[model samples]
Target: MLLLALLEAAGIAKLGASIGAGIAAIGAGLGIGRIGSSAMEAIARQPESTGDIRTNMIIAAGFVEGVALFAVIVCLLCLFL
Candidate 1:
């Protein structure tokens, strides 16, 4: 009975960690997708200004990727810590 109780508690802890990781990914996906779509639309509307648009898009994409990486790192820390 004691062993079963311990296992149940561990299972609950793991579930929380799993949920945290999943939420982080979802948030990152939404943010990155929004940045990408906006960049694409801007480029489509102004082909002549493609150079400037592409530069900004690359910068924005990098920011998005950085944030996502940070979230993932935090998630991993939470799981391990």
Candidate 2:
């Protein structure tokens, strides 16, 4: 509410882009944290599968990061163009 009021008062036209980038970054961070936490739990349960768990975690993290990066880039484009 406060943010909306501020933006409205400031008459910022690119607020949507800024908000989109922020949401994407925040979502990616949360997603990566959850993936890491789960992988750690799995590894703790099965030490023998540590390698597989770590590999899968990295792959999943990479995908999340890639999507976040794309979102941020699109948001930036919207802001600039």
Pick by TM-score: which candidate is best? 2
RMSD (Å) of each candidate, 1 decimal: 5.0, 5.4
Query: Model 2 compared with the native: what TM-score?
Result: 0.85
lDDT of 1 by residue, 22-68 (tens): 87778777887887788789889988988898788779778877887
RMSD of 2: 5.4
Q: Per-residue lDDT tens digits of candidate 2, residues 1-81?
A: 778567656757388889999999999999999999999999999999999999999999999999999999998886775
User: TM per model?
Assistant: 0.70, 0.85
Model 1 C-alpha RMSD to native: 5.0
**What C-alpha lDDT do the candidate models reach, one value each?**
0.75, 0.91
Residue 27 accuracy (lDDT) in model 2 = 99
